[model samples]
Target chain A: MTTRTVARRVLTLVVRGRGAQGGVWGEAVLREFDETVTTWQALRWAAGGIRVAMRERRRRAADARRAGARWRRVSRRIVIGSATAAAVLAVLNQFVVTIAYEPSAGMQPTLRAGSRIIVDRISLHFGGLSRGDLVQISLPTPAGRISAFKRVVGLPGDQISCRDGFLIRNGVRVDEPYLPAGSTIDCRALTVPAHEVYVLGDNRAASADSRIWGPVAERDITGRVLVFS
Target chain B: MPRRPDTSPQTLLLFRALLADPSQWRYGYDLSRETALASGTLYPILIRLADREFLETRWEPPEQPGRPPRHVYRLTDAGADHARERLAAAAKPSASSKKAATAPTPRLLGGAR
Candidate 1:
């Protein structure tokens, strides 16, 4: 056989081996070898084809490493972002304020049933409760502790009475515009002792409040209603 | 697979040749001949350089009939700059500790005399 034929046979074997190994570029390398003018040059081209195969293997490995690094960076960012969002929500719930739903119409004109209200827990730290401010009070019950919303009608050391269907505070008639039209509250005279406040609901007839359970302690007040929708 | 391209003698020789004409496109066979590198050594270097973006490639159609097309390569602008900086850094000693290293050593004055 001639030198050119021997070189072609060697290159064909090499190309077939590369193809079996999944090196798709074998055809391109074989084409380049076929164009070589001499047998020596063809042998050299076959050697270059093996190097090309090795190069492709290295390139694939590098690409895999880069893809893994990119995925790790993306996962890290998601974790940090979620943690930051959760932290902001926790701080808002504890130190700032939160939304509370009024489930009953006990406070009627002041706060209707099914109304959404913003309860400001932070404001209580700066000031004491005043008469007529709507407050949330936690009362012990047989089932568990239940929270109730009502208006502060009398403060510590004040005379309070609901006589003849009208409220009297400190020997004077108390004007409560929030009461529904023609609503009447009839109860016996009672004095608000120290560290306690008299509370009443605007819907007098339907409310279960201080009139039934007596005055609530000042410490039972949790927050005051800022606004409602 | 090597994490980085091997800085063998042939690799540096090929780099010097490519750096000489950074803007000009050169063929593979021509580079192999100029650098006296075997196809086994030459192609791996070329693939590594291209992978690192230190070289760019394109295909050139045959100038005559029956001759197959071939790939050509050239260094990009950033590639050339990186090559220049790396070569310069390799050629010189680091300046950070030069002053301390070259300072005169303390000696006992006239004690042995």
Candidate 2:
């Protein structure tokens, strides 16, 4: 191709590719004298340009470093700000259930008889309770057994009972799918109280839930379990 | 090209290795095998170094016309300087060592405290 044609082609390529104008022109300058510049030639120019740029950058960086007093002051303020934020978050997590402990065998098999769990207590902050959600209630007493971990079997005034080892709710046999095989219950014919729940365990034979202590008041409910964690 | 202050140990090691021949681009698997770093760890550092302008990365077009590309990394001018500094720093011991060597020692009281 002719020199003018090649220049036009290169110009068109530069426009189409939208390359770095400085670097591309630097390469173009090499191409003007010869059809193609070897990788070494291009690299040599790049190295020289980079060395100059680096020197300038280093000078600017040194000036910034000399103004360390201002940067130190800003950094200290930022550190203090972050520490305060972390402290606030720690306090918030304590109230919102960062961890949970299984006090008894009330909701066994699924959550184990006495397994300690780290509850994501924030789950209930956005979403409400659902049936079959094993919940932990935060009580005022420091009895070391303040939280009651149990599965929710009934809602407010949701008629619930046991019939022939089957959970009967609202005149229909509520399916207890998670319950272990050959488990039985004799606690039958009970109406869930107002603002109270009819709770039970998958291990009906060895649970100390509503059957023993009666229904729990809604005010006692702390938060619903999102996961075993 | 800006100097990349690499905080990660893996990145510091990688920069030192690349300083030997920076223009010769190294592949991911080769770097991973040579550095003994997991693929997950190596790839992230490569990307982070590239982001900080310490390294330049490119995907080598596959030998076949329509095949997955392989990534390659090379040290930029800024990366080379930073790597040299890091290497020099690694070679030198801290000023604290001298104080430790000459500091007064406390004698044991009753052979126990």
Give the per-residue Cα lDDT of candidate 2 at A168. Answer: 84
Model 1 chain B scores worst on lDDT over the 10 consecutive residues at: B104-113
Candidate 2 residue spans exceeding 4 A from truth: A1-95, A122-126, A138-145, B1-113
TM-scores, one per candidate: 0.43, 0.38
Predicted structure with the largest DockQ when compared to the true one = 1
TM-score of 1: 0.43
DockQ of each: 0.23, 0.02
Per-residue error for A126 in candidate 1, Å, reads: 26
| Predicted candidate 2 versus true structure: per-residue lDDT over A108-170, tens digit per residue | 677785676766566555565678887776543565547777788888778877787778889
Clashing pairs in 2: A118-A229
Please provide, for model 1 over A1-229, each residue's C-alpha lDDT reduced to its tens digit, 9 standing for 90 to 100.
9876776666556556545432334434555565566778777777777666555656666989999999999999999999999999877756577788788889898788988988888677568899999888888888988888899999988899877789999889899888889989887688999989999998998898888989999888888898889
Report the Cα interface RMSD of each model, rounded to 1 decimal. Answer: 2.8, 15.3
